[model samples]
Target chain A: MTELTEIKKQDLLYQGKAKEMYTTNDPDILWVHYMDQVTALNGKKKVQMKDKGKTNCAISARLFTELREQGIVSHFIEQLSPTDQLVQKVQIIPLETVVRNYASGSFVKRYQTEYLQKFDQPVIEFFYKSDELDDPFLNDDDALALGAATREQMAQIRQLALKANQHLRQIFAKMNVLLVDFKLEFGLTAAGDVILADELSPDNCRLVDLDTKQSLDKDVFRKGLGEMVPVYEEILQRLLKEGER
Target chain B: MTELTEIKKQDLLYQGKAKEMYTTNDPDILWVHYMDQVTALNGKKKVQMKDKGKTNCAISARLFTELREQGIVSHFIEQLSPTDQLVQKVQIIPLETVVRNYASGSFVKRYQTEYLQKFDQPVIEFFYKSDELDDPFLNDDDALALGAATREQMAQIRQLALKANQHLRQIFAKMNVLLVDFKLEFGLTAAGDVILADELSPDNCRLVDLDTKQSLDKDVFRKGLGEMVPVYEEILQRLLKEGER
Candidate 1:
């Protein structure tokens, strides 16, 4: 492993909807810049919201650090700037893992289930991470058939996701927020071990205020409830305030 | 457990797209008459073909008998006539279990994968069997949340489904037919045991001629290849000839 005190960012590798990845001098690391972008409906609806990137970056770093303290491994290395970070580079497994504690979003749309209905167990779903296919929802068998992830890798992801959910639910509950559901992505290490990857923030989480029941996450933007960034900043402030305690 | 020599068919219980169920004098038996009808695209396309009913009933009876001989329990009791049968009455679990050996039909439509692409292992999927909802695809967690089936029952269904696949594949292979994919419906017996139910014929399976690669099952109707009943009769003849051998 290169232990250079100063890592130089190199050519742009990939530009995603919300983040841009740049190669670093270190082969095992990449520099990520979170763009001030928000998208829904597979990038059909997009917006550039000021301070969105910085808010997400801070929340992601804080959550990753908290998870690391609780013995959950992630790709997060360190925050470089308000909108930038350095992370371990790995081949991302193309599966969008969603863990839902309460019925909402497509869960309600698909089965006509009652919104916010509590489930006995957290419902975990896998969606093929393909924009071309509109990110169709699939299952473990479909994921395996698509060669997205091995059976063992999926099992490992489920375990990690459940653990992260438990920790995250507690973290948000302490902030007087209801963690309804969240999405996570995983990558395979060079050693072929599965670890959590991707940014964690209100951007990918469905959160509701414990008392007011107002959506505190991306749904505010998705449903056109109000300005989304203010709600995000509110979550970050609570997180930082809880840190002081 | 009623052993009536003559089970009198009473009144119509349910009318499906391709069959009608009548309550029998015996509480544990259902009189089913396969109708001379075929539906595609979830009943938006409908047609009535001569000999379709008798052909499906015969094929379903033969296949169920073969499965029973292999120690696989199903609800089929006996064939009453060319188009009617007495089935052990079971509460149909509202799940359409699909097992795929090769990609075709909706699998191709969803993933845009090549048709007839073979899979390393059979991919099993579940859909909530609601006509009103258009039978949306779901997972084990979704099923559990909806109270569709228990973890143990799903495991059991998977096991039994795989076993049935093994036998059915060989039977089809011997007939010089390729077993592509099929849908199976399971039901719960009064004692709470899950067992295979529903008709098994060209109506619910995707089969192709081994040499010609022409679809011999419902795809003939779904894709509008030609008259479908003759192709179904071809399958019936092949199955019967294999039995004679």
Candidate 2:
């Protein structure tokens, strides 16, 4: 077991799967250790998905760079190493924000209607906490009833999610891939300014080849399609090769 | 094809499959036609799960009655008929809010983690519009970036979501059913007050027999476990039977 000692030496705060988060003396600065360990199924089933940590760090760093180039603010300051990231430590808002541009996953399972036929309009959803219960889809009333967010804040979140989705979609389109969907996190400063938090990596998104429909994200493991890590590496190699050109 | 026809004498708004919403000229009250059209997978794959809509209505009515009895504020005014609901018309919010108490669905898929472990803390999530992209989980920054909510409002939503979860969990525990997870929605009144909105039906929740592990919600369809509607009916019957005792 990778104890918290190594992280504590650097003033660790929280230890989440794949990353040991540390708070620097400066409240705004954070150091995250992209550990070698990999977790699946919410840490219930831990498998040493070899090199996953390094791969995620590299991919995330690259994606963050791309996002920044496109004017999307993210926490990624720089790649400290293949397995570390230096970031801004904002107070993370406890919400997993998602935006979608295509039809897939629970949406397919929920409505099972034709509404998903290349829906030009984006839709938003909110899920309250209790990961052990698994995150369930919620509506606005439920949100208010549960006090997960206020009506006004939810409106703001929706706009932000939509903007992020649009920006990422444009970037991926240029790369000949469709940014199907992605997860984002946000944090607040003590002063109450919300900033984009969390890592933007292949692990948190779904990327499909425009021509062949090949996935370049962690959906392979999720769907049990097989050999996902290699597929991810291949996608990175392809991106690198294209960059060289 | 359910087409909307205005009964010239009566004003009505044919809202989606689940409800036919209408209002009296007075505008203080609202009538909803709780239809029997139970759609799964957005109506792409239809299963004639008989008595599903009625069961959901009954289940929702019964659950709301219990919630009211417990002094939980909810939108349910009264059950007009087996398939219709009478409610107070308020400004509706177009967001789906979800809260989970146990692990299930995409959480299992995305995290590829355990099914039903208790979390040290509840984890709230948000998704932007469009289920076709399958409700993508989101964070606060994404929420704000999309402009769906404000900073203070998001905080309030979190508190509300947590409170609702606690209330529901307590109620279900007394009923000897585990409130595994459920969806909720909220709306604001003309006076800028947030109130619980929507029907709390079996369709929107996952309930299981405390002893037998028989599912009481719509997870059957999502998981393709088979005969989901009947399973829902069975659960209702069980609840009814318990009430008789």
Candidate 3:
């Protein structure tokens, strides 16, 4: 498990790959220490994949900034350093929320049809919070039956996801990239407000070139079909170019 | 797009490329006609194979029967014929509920560390309900945020997913196969009951021979490794042989 040596006198709150999370004894804030590592094929294969952490951190910071500019609530308080982030730690939600603008990957596998030729309305899916299960999809009734959320809260989350989707679509379109789809996580504040939490990086998002279908995110690694860091760097350059414009 | 004529419906449904879905005029019954067309990815390219539907339907029916015998609630009502299934009509849950007994897929991609290696615990994930979007993962909070599920519903769905995991593990273990992971869907009745729904076929599962690690499910297509139908058929023969004991 990755350890947070920078934060003092706090018990390790939780540890996940790529980051070590800790509480500051204040109970209101959480500190995440990002590490430089990369994995693929369900950990059956691993490589140092140098500078991945920094690249992901920079990408996440840029995205969070863009998302905040668009009025979406996010946990990113500040970039403590290139390798760390200070965030308003809310009750981290367990689900992996996704919003999609185009078709690809498992969608093609599941339908086994040519539906990907046309863009469909953005859709939302819920998976139970278990990684060993490889993040299966869940339906509204299934979520309700699980008792993890109330009807009102589920409604609020959906609205926020859609709003986030709209904002992301607009932002990516401006960059001449398709937002194809992306995963999101959320948490509850002490006051019970659901806010977006988690890193919004190239790793969790699938950004494709509008014309070439060139992928600019971590799907490159999972599919084992393309180079990783260069693609990340290329996307960063694109974002920077867009910013300059 | 594959259609079934009345005369060929039985064999075609049992052995077709896609299932034919029909809604009863009464609105209380749903009909699913299975087909015979099969496709597989033997290595890097997808190939249209033959007689996959029959192999999958037989295997799915057998597994559903085994699950039901073990007191697991599933969408399978009964095998109507060699090619069709008679199931209680319910609102098909749009989520593909997956439970994994082993580490695999995107779980490794996200964490990028070995501490989470092949978790002994099952992990659940929710993917959004859009083939056009590539079935991207969504977290519980995101699912709630998207109005796809309530907190309470998610909890229930998680419990059900875990239970199903246990059931599948037990059955597969007895047959000397590792139930690596499987996808599931749930549905809601008009009376607000959540029940397991969707086809439990080789297409939706990854079965590995306990000794050989030879795949017995649809991953043969995803990986593009060839001779998938034969692999499925081999698993069926094995399961049948095991049942005789």
Each candidate's root-mean-square deviation in Å? 1.0, 11.3, 11.5
lDDT of 1 by residue, A140-163 (tens): 888999999999999999999999
Candidate 2 lDDT, tens digit per residue, A1-245?
22223322257798887789988655567788777665556667565677778888887787777667766677787777787887877866556776666656655555453422354466555555446656555555445544556667667667767877887777677678888777777777666666677877777787888898877787777767787778768667765665565
Q: Which stretches of candidate 1 lie over 4 Å from their true place?
A: none
lDDT of 1 by residue, B1-245 (tens): 56756799999999999999999889889999999999998999999999999999999999999999999999999988899999989998888999999999888889999999999999999999999889999999999999998999899999999999999999999999999999999999999999999999999999999999999999899989999999999999999999998
DockQ of each model against the real complex?
Answer: 0.89, 0.05, 0.04
lDDT of 3 by residue, A1-245 (tens): 12334444366788766667888755666877766766655556666677778778877888888888888888887777877777787876667777766656655555443533444457666665666755656544435544456567777787888988887777788888888778888889888999888888777788888888788887788777677989888778777788787
Show model 3 residue runs off by greater than 4 Å: A1-11, B1-245
Candidate 2 lDDT over residue span B131-233, tens digit each: 4655454445445544555557667666766887787777677677888777777666667666677788777877887988877677777667677767777
Rank list by lDDT: 1, 3, 2
DockQ score, prediction 1: 0.89
lDDT agreement of model 2 with the native: 0.67
Worst 10 residues of 1 chain B by lDDT: B1-10
Worst 10 residues of 1 chain A by lDDT: A1-10
User: By TM-score, how accurate is candidate 1?
Assistant: 0.98
Residue A235, candidate 2: alpha-carbon lDDT = 62
Error of 1 at B20 (Å): 0.8
CAPRI classification of candidate 2: incorrect
User: Rank order by DockQ, top first?
Assistant: 1, 2, 3
